[model samples]
Target: MTDDRFLYDPDTAVDPLGDAEATRAAGRSSKHNYAKVGSGRPSSLLYNYGPGAIMDLPHFTVMSTGLDDWERMWRKRVDSPPEIHAPRLREVVAKLLRSRNVRLRPHPNQPRKTGLSREGNDLGVPARVFPQWMRCTGCDLLAPLSHFGYTNTHPYRPDQARFEHERCPGRSGSRSGKNASRAAVPARYLLACVDGHLDEFPYDQWVHHWSPCPKVEFPVLRMVDRTAGKGASAVIHCATCGARRPMNEAQGDAGRSKLPRCRGRHPHLDAFELNGCGDATRLMLVGASNLWFPMTQSIIVMPRSANEETSDLAARIRVAFASKPHRLEKYEATGDLEGLRDALDGKLDGPVDEEAIPDDQLAKALGEALTSGESDEDLAKWRADWDPVDLLVPEWNYLLTDPLGLGHEDEASGLTLSHRDRAPGLRKEIVRVLAVERLRKVNALVGFTRIDDVDRVADLSQRMVPLARAARPAWTVATEDRGEGIFLQLDEPAVAAWEAQVEQDQLWLAHRAAHRRNFESRTSDTAGPVDAEDRLRPPRYWLVHTLAHVLIREMALECGYSAASLSERLYAWPGSDGRPPAAGLLICTTAPDSDGTLGGLVQLSEPERLHRVVSSALYRAGRCSSDPVCGMRTPQDTEDFLHGAACHCCAMASETSCERANRFLDRRFLIDLPGSGIGFFGLPG
Candidate 1:
C-alpha cells in the first residue's frame, strides 16, 4: 500500500483551468487541452466512460470523479456559472435527446476553478491525487514515494526520513555514487476484476505466496532486469526472503492462473467492495490504449422536436425562445414550450426572473415565430404530412428530400446546404449530396470496460459506474460538439440489387462466423455473453460503412481537414415493419473547441468536386499499399476475425473516428477482383 499522504498533496497546489501569472504574462488565459484525442469515440467503446470511468492521463490515471465532487478540485468558484461550467454545445445536446425518451436537461451549474503557478503557467485544479504506488527503477523496490529520498535521483530506502536523505546510514555496502543515483517512477502494472474493482499489482504476496514472511517484517524487495527485454525479461527479488520470480507471464491467459485472486479494490473513490468477489483479476498496464473504452450514443437533429411535421416548427420555436427568459413562462403556459422551460432553466445560473418580459409580448413573439395568421387546418396538414410510425426515418427523409429543410431562412444554426450533381457511372449508385450547413453531436460517456472485448458485454450496468456515491445516479457529465457534414444516401435500387446477390451474402456469413469465434475467445468471461441482436447486421451495412470510411479519408485530403478531425455516423439499417430502407452515410467534422462549421467539409459536397473525391476514393480502395497479402487474407486468417480486405493502410480509421470499433468491415465487397465478382460498384464501368 502507498502512503495515504501522497494521495493528495495539500501543500502542493494546482490550478487546472489557468493561472493568473501565466495569463498576464501571455496577455491571455492559459490554454487547457482536455482530452487531446477529441470527444467522439467509436460506438463500441461508448460503454466504457460513464460517471466513474477510469481515464489515463500523461503523468497519472484518473477516475472521472463524480459530478457532485467536481467543486472539491477547484481552488476558487466563479459566480453565475453556466449549466456545466463548461460550454453547453446547444445543437449537439438538443440532437442527442430528441429521440431518447429522456428530456434534454442542462448540466449542473457550478463554477469550476483553477490556479496560477510561479513561472506564469496554468496548473491542474487543486484536487486530491491518489498515489497508485511507485516502483524504484534502480532497486526495483515497490513502495510509496515516501520510501525514497526526496532528491530528484534517489533509490528506495525505507529508513530514509521523508524529504531528508542526508542522515541515512544504510549506504555502507553500496557502491560510491551508485547508491541513490536513479529515481523511482510510478509502477505501470495494475490488476482489475470484472466486478469493476481495481487494485495495484500484488508484488509482495506474489514473491512470498500465502506463507508468512520467514524473515524480517520489513523485507527489502528489488526489481532487477537481468535479461535483454526490459519489462518482459525483468525479475522481482525479495532481499529478505531470498525468493525471486520473473514478471513475464503477468498478462496473458497462462498468467491469470498464476496471479492471486482479486481483493476487490476501487482506489479512485477511496472505497472498496468489501463484500468479497471471487472473479479472477486481469493484469493491465496503466499506459495501454485498450485500458479504457468509453461507450457513447448520438442522434441526428430533426426539424420537428418530437413528432413529424412539427419538427420544422419546433426548430423555429426553439430559435425564437433562445436567450429570452421572459417568453418562457408564456411559451410554457401555451403548451408550445411546457416541459422545455424546466430543461432550459437549468442552463441559467438561477431561477428565471418572472419580470423579465410581459406574458402578452412573449406570446406575440411566439406567435410571430410561427406561420403568420395560420389557420388550424394548416397546422393539421403539417402534422399529417409527418410519418409518426417511424421516428428516425422521417428525420432522415427530411434531410435527404426536403429542399426547404436546409433553407437559409434561419441564420442561427450557421448551416449551409447545396445540391451536388452526380458524377458519371456513380449516378446510378449514389443518389444526391444532402449537404449539411451545421450539425451538433453530443456524446455522453455512458460506461467503460477494461481487459475485455467490447462485443462480449451485453448489460451496461455491469460495466458503468453511477454519477453519485449511491448505487444509482440521475446524472452524468457529457460534452457536446457542433460541426458541419454531408449526407450521401445510397440509391435504394442499387443497394437492394447488391443485397440480393448470393455471393455477397455467403461472403459476409463466412466473415461473421470467424468473427464470432474470435470474439468469444478474446472476450473475458466476466464480460458475459454477447447480445444476440447486436451480432448480426445486414451486408449492405458493411458496404456503406466501408464507403463512409473511404469518403472520409478522401475528403480529409481534398478539404484541408485532418482525418482525425472527421467522424462518421451510419444510417444503413434495412427497412423492416412497413418502413423504408435507410441506407446513407453522414461524414461530419467534429471539434470540442470550435462551432464545427468551418465550410471546408460542405464545400467538398459540390457536384464537380464530389465526383473527384468518389473516383479517387474508389481508385485507392481497388488497390492498397499493402496489397495481395492484405487483400488475399481471409477473416479466419486475421487475428480479430472481424476484418476482411481491410488493413491499417486502407480501411481502418483512427480509433476516435470509427463508430464500430473498426469491426465488420470488408473493402472486397466494394470493388471487384479477378475471383471476387460481387463488387457493389460493378468493376468501374
Candidate 2:
C-alpha cells in the first residue's frame, strides 16, 4: 500500500491563507520514515504546486515536471487520470489556449489498500529531483547528485527515500567511522529570471568569477555556514584553489551584474530554450515563495438552461464536424442525421465524447450544428470571445431571479439552489437571499510565474509561464470541489444611491487615488503601457467587498465554521453599455469530497437568523479594539497600500475568504467611521 504520508488530504494540507510552505515544512520534519513526504491535497496541484513548481519533500527537493511528463507517466498506468467536468471553466480555458480540443484532468490519486505493494503502482504526478546539487551535512562536502549515493530503505515508504554522501570523510578526516556517510540536503540557493526560467545556483562560477580555476580544471568546493543569522554568513569556498565568495554578494541591485544572463532553462522539463532568454538572472532561495506562483482560473458551476445546454452541445458538434469536412459536406447535402449517425457509428473523435453523450441529445445537437452554419472559423471566433466578467453575469442573474425555483437540482451540473425569502428588516438593503444547498467549483492551473503574483485576466497570456516546452499544452490540470453557500444580492437602487453619495466624498477620493497609485507602482516594471480603466474601482466594489468581510467574520462566530473555512465572492460591477449594475456577495465553503460540508452555513440563511447576523456584523464593523488609529487610517499618499479604514482586527478577512486579498475594503463604507457620514448602515436604537 502507498504510505499514508504520501497522500495529501486537501482538508488538512491546504492553508486557509493559500500558503503551502507550512504544510511542506511539516512533511520535511516528519519523524516517521513511513510518514508522508510529498503529501498535499489535490487542490495543491492546482494552486500552490502545479507543473514547473519546486516542492520540498521529506528527503528531497523536487520540481513538478511539465504536463508532457505527466501524460507520459500516466500512460504507463492502466487507469487514466480522472477528468473534471466544469463546462464554463473548460470554455474559458479553451479560449485562453485558443484550441477547441482541451481537457481538464486532476492529478492521479489511486485509492490506497492496507497491504498493497507500490510496485508497478507509481501512478501519481511525476516530479524530478531539482537543483541536482546537494551539500553533505557532516563534512560540508558539496557536489552534484551524481556524486552521491541514493537509498530507499523502504520502497513502499517514499519518506525513507534519501541521498547520502557515501564516501564522505568527517571533519576529523576519519573515513572508517559511522559518520562517514552523511545525509545530503539540497543546495540552499537557486537561480531564476522573471521569464520563469530556473537553474541551479552558479556556485562554481560565483566562486571563481567566470574564470577557470588557476590550480585545477575542476575544483572541489564546500558550502560553509558560519551559523550566523544572515546570508553573508554562508560562503562557497573552492577547496582546490581557495577561491571564496559570500552568498550575500549575489543579492539586490549590486548582484544583478555579478550573475550571468538567463540560460532559459526549464529544469523540470530537462530542456533549454533554443534562443536563450535575454533577461538577467536573480539569486533565489529554494523555498522562497516568489520562486513559484500558480496562475489559476476558477468558477462556481451554475446550472444552464435547456436552450443554453443545447447551444453548447451544438457548438461542440460543429467543432467535431469541422475536423471532418467530408462528414459535414455529407450532412449538409442530405440535410438529415443519416450521415452524422454513420460518422458516430464509425467512432468520430473530437471534443464531444460520444460515450458520455446521449443519442437524443446528439441528434438534436447535430440538427442545430447543421442548421446554424457555423464554419470552423466562426466556431474559433466564438471560442476566442470570452470575458472574465461575463462568467459572473449569468451567476448574478440566476441568484436574483431563481428562474429554476426552490428545490432545483441538476445531478450532472452538481448545482442545487433554493431561493429563500428576504430577511426581515433587510428588505430595503438585501434584495434576495439564496440557500445554495449544493454547488460545484472547478479550479484549473494554466501556468505559473517566478518572483511575482500576476493575476490580471487581461495580462494572463503575456505574464504566464508555459507548462510545456512546446508553444501550447494539450491539456491543463484542474480539480472539482462540491459544497454549499449563502448568496445575498443587495438592492441595486439602494446600492446605486449610496455609491453616488460616496463618489464625491473626500475619504473615497483618497482611497481611489491610492488605488491608482498602487496599480501604477505594480505595473511600472512591465513593458506594456497601463490601461487607465484598470486603476479605477467603483465605490460599490469597496462597499460590497468590505461588507462581505464583516459578514464573514460575524458568520464564522455564529456558525460552526471557522473564519478560514468561509469564502466570499463579490458581484460588484458598475453599469456600462446598457448592462445593469450588480452589488452582491456569496459566502460559501467547499471540499474535494462528493458529500460536501454539513449545511452549517446554509442553515444560517433563514430569514430571522440572517437578519440577526447582518445586524451584528454591521454593529461589529463600526467598532474595533484597534480603532481610533485604524479608523483614521487612509490609503492616501501610499503607493503600495490599497485599503483604508480596514485592518486585521476589523474589516480584513482571511486571505482565502477575501477575493481581493484584503484590498479595496473599508469599514467606513459599511458603517460610519466615527463622526463621518459615509456609513452604509446605521445602528438601531
Candidate 3:
C-alpha cells in the first residue's frame, strides 16, 4: 500500500465547513498514478491505494494515529453514536426526576416494570424489544415508547401504527421487545468488495445532517476538476464503516435545484480527527463497540442545547403535522400528483381550533403534502394548524426530494477522478441507456398495422393528429435565448414536422413493428403510410434516435433538470421515487427568423441522455439550413451530401456562427467550461 499519510494529512488541518483556509492537498500522491487510464496496475487497484496508496486496507486499524482515525471517529459518532447503557440512562433519569419532582400514577392493567402514560399504554420500551426504542432510565424492562421507529401521529397509512404509548420494531423483528432495543447500529457502516461493490450498513442508522456542505476536500487527492461549473453534490458513504451522509442539503450549496437553502454550522463535526479504524470487529454494538477502537477523531464536541434541538425538531414536527397526506400507491403507479391529491382528498384550508378540523380533514391535509408533495412555503403554515404536543417527525426532506443517497461516489476506490466535464459524456451515456429503453418500447408498438389490429392503431393514430400540427406550434414555456442562432438548435427542424414525418423518418419502426407483430401478419415493411424509398437502417435509426434524444433533452431542460442531471433523471425514467431523465415528450421552439437563413429548429423535451447532440445542417455559408432549405444550397454541395447540405451536430449552445462571411466567426469550443458566451444568460449553459 502507498504511504497512508499521503492520502490523509490531517496534520495540515482541514476546515470542511470552510472555517479555516480550506486546505487542499493530495490525500495521496503517486509518482506513477495507478488510478490513471494508462497505469498498467489496472484501475481496480486505485481503491486499494492504486500502486501508490493503500486501497483495501481492512478498517480494523481505522483508529490508528493521525487523520485516518479522525475520519473513523467522525463516521462512528455521526452515524451511530455509542448505544446509551441502561445504567447510565437510569442515572440521567434519577437526576432529571430528582430535579423535576414528578409522581407517576400506578395503573392496574400495566405490567410490573412498564411505565404507563395517562392512557393505559406502555410508556418506555426496552431497547431489545423495540429495536428503535431507548432503554428506560428508571425501569430496566422494555416499555412501549413513542420516539422509536418513526410514527405518524395521525393516520398517514391505512394501518394506524401510532399510539399514546406506541411500541414498534423496525427492520429488526423481535419476538419480544427485548431484541429490538439491544441491537444498536453495527460497528462497520460500510462494506467494500475487492471488485468495487460498496454496501451501506442500514438506511436508518444515518443521521440526516441538515447543513450545506461547503466543498469536498481531500488533503492528498482532491479531484483536480471539482472547482469547475456547479452541479449536484453526491451522497458519499464511508467505505470502511458504511456510515453514509449527503454532501449537501440541496444539490450542493450552489442554486442548482429549486429547494430553499438550509442554514446551520456543522454540528456533528468531529471535535478531533481519526484517519482510520484501529480494530478488527466487523460488527459490534453498544458503547463497548468503541472498546478496542481508539477514539481517533474524538474532539469532545459540545452537544447542541435542548432548546436548539427541541425547537428544530418541533419545527420539523409542525411541518409534518401541517402536511397534507395523499395516497402513495397511486402516486407510484400513475405519477399523477394532481390525481394523488384528489385520491387523498388533498389539504384543507382555514383554522383548526374550532373544536373542529375533523380527523379526516387533518388526514386530508397530510395527504396533500405527502402525495401532492410540499413546497418550502407549505412548511410555514404550521401555526394554529398543528399541535406540537402530538407531532410526527417525518423525514420531510426525503419525501420532497425525488430520491435519497443518489449521485454518491465511492470512497475507497476513489472513483471520482478529474472527470468533472464528463457530465456531458454522462448525458450521452444516459441517452444511450434511454435509447435502448425507447427501443424496448417499440416492442409494444409491434404488429399494430394489420387490419384486424388496426383498431389499436387509433391509439397511436390519435398522437398523429397533434403530430400533424407540431410545426410552428406555440409552446407553453419559452426559454430566453433560442439555441437556433448557434449551430446547436438549428439542425433537423422537421424531426416530427407532420404526422407523415414519423413514417417518412421511420421513427416508429421498432415500436410499430413490435406492436404489429403482436396481432397480425406482417405484410408491409412500412407501418403507417409515408413517402417512397425510405428504409430503416442503423444510420437511419440512429438519426431518429438522436432526434428522440433531442426532444427528451429539451423537455428535461424545461422540466427543471439541468444538463448535468439529464443523465441522472433519464437513466432510470422515474416512476415515483426516482427521476429517470424525462423522455416523455418534446417541446419544439421556432425562432421567428427562420426564413431560409436559419430555418426552424426542433427541440425535444425529456430526453434520455445528459449530453444531447442536436444535428442542424450548416454550410460554408454558416446558415442553419434544415429541411426544405437543403435545396437552398447549390446542387454542387448536394453532390457530397446527397442533398447539398452538411449535417452539423451540436450540443445545447447559444449565439450564431458565420463561417463563410469575409470575416468568419470562429466557433470557439468551450472546453470544460459550461458555456463561455457573453452575458448572464450564457452563464448557466
Candidate 4:
C-alpha cells in the first residue's frame, strides 16, 4: 500500500522493475513486500524511528528492518540514497563502531513524479508486520495474520490497508458461513527484556501454562474484553479446550515469573540469536513512550583547514564524490583530474551545483582525499585514546576563541557566523553572544535501547543494541540539517565564585547527594563498576544547563519558532582530563530544508534585545505557576529524580530541545529563589 504520511515527497516514483529485485534483496515474503507503506523526514529516521524501531501506521504496526536490508535495496539500485558528510561526526562514529570505512547514508528520497503513470513509487525503508498476531474486532477472534485475509483496496492510500477476518463465523459457532468479518487490530501487549529483545506476548503458552492443549492440537484463542476497566478484565480464552487466563497475569513482578524468557528475537532482522536470551521478559504496552529510545550522536560541521575557503571547497568536493563513488574510485585509480571533470560535466548525477566548482579547488580537494587515505591503522590509534568528552572540547574552543577567524559566511560549508558586540551595560554574568547565521548539524543513528533511556550515561556502548545483527555493520543511516543558532558564553570568574559559595551550602550539598543516589540507583543493574565522572554533573553544569532552558523558553515566545523547533547544546565541564573549564550553551533551530528558519533567533541575540530577554527570562524563572511547591521542592534522598526545583511549568524544555532529556536542570541555579543564594542571576528589578 502507498501512503504519503511518512514520505518526504508523496508523488515520487521508483522503477517498477526494481520491486522484484528489492523484495529478493530484502529477503521478505510476498505478503511482506515493499509498497511505499509510509515515509518520514530524514531527521525523524535518526531520532524517532531508525532501523529496528517499531512504528505505528494508520492501519498497521511495523518494525523497520536492519541496515543489511537497506544495503540490499541500494545494491539493487531500487533507490539512490544521498550521503551526508561531517568529518567530526564520522570520526566519532568510527571510534564508537570500531570501523574505518563506515558510510553515512540518509533515507531514500526522490523528486515528484511528473509522468502520467505512477505505477511504482514503492521506494522507502523496508519494514515487516510486527506482533504478527491480530484480533477480529467483531468476534474477538485471536490468531496470527496468516489466518486472516489482508487487503489494500487503494494502492495509493496506505491508510486504507488493513486485515480482515474474511472467514469470521460471528461470535457464536452457530452463525456459520456468515460474513461478520471486521477490521483486525494488533494485540495491545508486547514482551521485551532489558537486553533489547522484543517479541509478541506469548498467548498460547500463557493460557496453557507452557504446555500443549490436552484436548486439541491447534487451539483457537479469543481475547474477550469483559467490558470492565484495566488489563485484568481482559481475558484470553482457548476455544478448543476452554483454558483461560487474565492479561494481568502477564504483567508486573508476578508477570516475570509467569512469562517465558526472552527468545532473543529481533523481529526487524527476521532472525533470532542462536542461543536464547536468558533475561526475564517484561510486559510492555505497544504505544508506551519507553518502548524505544534512540541513542544518536550529532556534531556541528566545522572547518578542518585554517583557510575557510579551502575547507568549504573541500567539503563540497567530498560531498560530490560521496554521491558518485564509482567516479571517486576511478579518479583514485587513474589520478586523472580531466577524466573526473569530464565525468562530472557529462551528467549532473550528484549535487546540481557541482558543475559550478572551480577547477583549482576541485584539484586541491582531490589531492587531499587521495593523500589522506583514512588508514585503519591511524583510526585504530585514534580510537585507542578517544574520549567522548573530547568531542565537545574543540567545539567549545571554536565558539569562544574563533581561532580560524570564521566570521564570514560560507555557503559550501553551511557555517555562517558574525560576532555581536557585547554591550558594556549588559549583565556581567554573560560574557559573549555570537549569532550563528547558518549551521549544519549531522545526526547519525548508532543504536537504540528499550525500557530505559541511557541519554546521560557515559558508557552507552554497554546498553546500546546494534541496528543490524552483524558483528560489524558497513554503514549506518544519518541525516544533515541546515539551521541557525545563538551562542552564549558565561563569565568564568563569576560562575567559579558562585560554584565556590554553593559548595558548602546545605541545600547544594543535598542536591549533590541526591544526584549520587540517583546515579547509583539508575546504574545498579549495569554490569561494570560505575564511574562518578560518567554520571555525576558538576555544579557549573547545572548553572549553564538551567540557564539554557530558561532562555530557550523566552526566545521561543518571540522567535517565530515553536519551543519544539528549538534545541540546546550545553558545553559545561569543570576542567577534567586535561580539558579546560567550559561554560556555554547554543540555542538553535534546525530543519531538513535547504534554507533553515528565518533569523528570528539571531535577532534576539542583539546586545540590547538579549539583555531584555535574559532579564525577563530570569524574572519569570524566579517564580513558577507551580511555585511554593515547585520552588521549595528538592531531589529527596529516597527519589531517583535528577532535577531540583524544576518542573514542566517552569524550566523544563521539550524532550527534543533538551539534550539531557530535561535532566540536571534547576531554576534555583539560574535565578534567585527565596533564601537560595546559589542563583547565578539576581531577580530583575
Q: Is candidate 1 or candidate 3 better by TM-score?
A: 1
Per-residue alpha-carbon lDDT of model 1 for 184-244, expressed as tens digits? 4556677777666667777777677746568877677666654533555656678887988
Decide which is better by lDDT, 1 or 2.
2
lDDT of 2 at 15: 16
Please give each candidate's TM-score: 0.71, 0.87, 0.17, 0.83
Local distance difference test, per candidate?
A: 0.56, 0.74, 0.22, 0.74
- In model 2, what is the error at residue 282, expressed in angstroms? 0.9
Candidate number that wins on TM-score, 2 or 4: 2
Error of 3 at 224 (Å): 27
Query: Best-fitting candidate, measured by TM-score?
Result: 2
Sort the predicted structures by TM-score, highest score first: 2, 4, 1, 3
**Tens digit per residue, CA lDDT, model 3, 1-685:** 2132122233433222221112224344322211111111211211111111112121111111122222333342243211111111111221222211111111012223332222312111001111122322211222223332422232112133221222323222435553333321112223221111112222222222333222432111111112223332334343333344542332322422423221210111111112432221121121221111100000001122334333322222223233232334344455554543454332211111323334444334334334332333443243213221111011111112221232222231111111112234222212211111010000000001111122222122211111001121111010111111111111122222222333432323333343333323332222345322222122222232233333334533443433322221111111233321122222222211112112122122113222343222111112233523431322231121111222343322222211011111111111111122211111112
Q: How high a TM-score does candidate 2 get?
A: 0.87
Poorly placed runs, candidate 3 (over 4 Å): 1-500, 504-685
Candidate 3 at residue 238, lDDT?
Answer: 32
* Model 4 ranges off by over 4 Å: 1-34, 76-80, 111-120, 173-177, 226-229, 306-387, 402-407, 455-459
- Runs in model 2 lying further than 4 Å from the true structure: 1-37, 78-81, 113-120, 172-179, 314-387, 403-405, 455-459, 638-640
Candidate 2, residue 210: CA error in Å?
A: 0.2
Task: Kindly report which residue pairs in candidate 2 clash with one another.
Answer: 1-116, 5-36
